[model samples]
Target: MNDVTQPVSRTVGILAGMGPAAGVDFVRLFVAACESWLREHGHPVLDQSYPEHWMAQLPVPDRTLALSDASAEQPLDAMARGLRQLASLGATAIAIPCNTAHAWHAALQERVPEVELLHIASETATDVERRGLARVALLATEGTYGAGLYGHAFDALGIQCLLPDQAARKRLMQGIYDGVKAGDLALAQQCFTEVGEQLRAQHGDIALVMACTEIPLALPQAPAARGWTLIDPTAILANALARRAYARA
Candidate 1:
């Protein structure tokens, strides 16, 4: 038996499955980051040395519907239950890779105040500030756009968030729903690239924030040469979780 007073091992709980694919992708990215971090620090880069984590792929009600329809079942209770499950399993911190789901962040945290809920928007906004990026384009779902979650975070940090106009937003929605979500990677990539190009042309020197978890799956990671920095919120959140999980006293 282990000593109760000994420092507890850090365990990160991943609340995912909003689209299923993004959830799985977030886990893979996190494990890769952990491996990279372990190797760089001269630690054993074996799987056993990596941080303990639980990916709770809950089948919660649709967040977009909950936000848009007044009568639709809210995801708050379901999300809270997922967090409680993680806490019950000894997870110290929780990370949700979905930006749209963060609309209920305040209420979710209120329900599970004992557990740490990492904010993706706030973290990404901080990165924007750190990189001295004054303006950046946002590519996200209609629910996220309506919630203004990213807007509030960026505004708080004095960073300008550029969003898609109505027509562009429609194209983005089709790319995500008809292309990425529908398992047509090629179509999705083409649509995303076109939107990015237009956004870049309209707003020069602006970085593109793949605020939607699905966008990262379709968007090219090496688009820096195209005059736009692609920021993946999943990467940002994953790295943060790794830090908290592997932090040395």
Candidate 2:
């Protein structure tokens, strides 16, 4: 008789719902990543081959509003509650798909110190560095910019992080709040394309970092976005999460 050993499974948690659409998108990306990981490990792509994962799509306060105004509702307590719930459920690795929500990452990490909380900006920065690109344009919410999430990560690699001018930044914000979050993807397409064009015209054919999870939904196929490389932080983060969840003991 031959002895057989079962493959070990690890749990990955997704703390999402800063906006429902982005959370759903992250799950799709994560599943695709898991399939890729299975193939790389020489395993058949079966449903049982996938890792155990849980998604807590809770309604947290607006991250941008919380960051921009002191009087606005804060997201920390709500976010902390979600993290505790996931941890209690045996999630050993976690990913937060919302970029703006990362402004509270430190506090959240402190809350769940035992879990591996993936950092989207750090993953994106590592991807960018691996591609050997030295300059990239960032498109994100005002809150992400204010927190210097990508900027701090890219700075360590000596990458030049280009940002939109004030007016263009406002346009980006309008696209995020009124367009994607409000279920108006057409408006988001327009706003994001214009900003991409403006940045490309100013900097000339550089890569555009879709730092906000919502930006990729509207910007990827825009005609004006032709001839530019789009760096998707969410996708990079998903890949990172897969690598962590599937690591050999």
Candidate 3:
């Protein structure tokens, strides 16, 4: 799925900072993927290409904000406001790289009706359905579980999603919060690998979805992902944005 680009100025609105580090990985993916895209096409190393207007370093949600269900409205408001601001700066399209933040997607879309948003759930679900995988395992944060936004997409596609047990879910969520988001790469890696191991031990091939954008940063294509098919939402989101940009061209 590699091709050369004609080098156009593209602005991607990134609504990020669901623990900040995950946000960084999303931007890095776009740059590396696009740069690698150029190099693969036999183009001179593109130096002035990513004209993407990114409003990074936005005020991060505190523990109270992210942990509280009642605080959902505020963060969604902040995200919508951020997108509106970025759109004013000429962002042609928008993408939110955070999975948990997607729980409030309804609210955000309702408030900011003008910007075209690249949805991870719907687009990623399309890929999952194309693979003909009926039963899959989801590994994400508490918000994703509590909200079931990803689950809604899979359900609509008639896919069955299996989640980790409660204890495992707790450790995994903590891994996202105290580990990966905290920059503790080792712990994050351990948590994700352990979860993957558990899923594989079920004695059947299980499709694993890294429903959280922060996941692949810790649990990449390693031993844990060897037997199981790992679906990355962030990569899917990036490709969706690229295709949308292409269609507009």
Q: Please provide, for model 1 over 1-249, each residue's C-alpha lDDT reduced to its tens digit, 9 standing for 90 to 100.
A: 533322334887999888899999999989888877777776765546777899998888888778899799888888999999998888878999888999999999998988889999998999889999898999988889999989999999999899978888888878888888799877787778878888988987678999888898988742533545899889999988888787753
Q: What is the C-alpha local distance difference test score of each model?
A: 0.85, 0.90, 0.74
lDDT of 2 by residue, 4-100 (tens): 3324668889999978899999999999999998787777777777888899999999999899898998999998899888888888889999999
State the TM-score for model 3. Answer: 0.85
Residue 131 displacement in candidate 3 (angstroms):
2.8
Per-residue CA lDDT of model 3 for 1-249, tens digit only, reads 223544654676777776577678777777666666657655566455444557454664642346455635356557877888877877777888888778767777777787787788888899899988888898987778887877899999999988888888888877677777788878887888888888778736787899887788888845656656789888888767655443434
Q: Rank the candidates by TM-score, best first.
A: 2, 1, 3
What are the runs in model 2 whose C-alpha is more than 4 Å off? 1-7
Candidate order by lDDT, decreasing, is 2, 1, 3
TM-score of each: 0.91, 0.96, 0.85
Which ranges in model 1 have alpha carbons more than 4 Å from their true place?
1-8, 221-227
- With candidate 3 superimposed using the best TM-score fit, by how many Å does residue 62's alpha carbon deviate from the native? 5.2
Residue pairs in clash, model 1: none
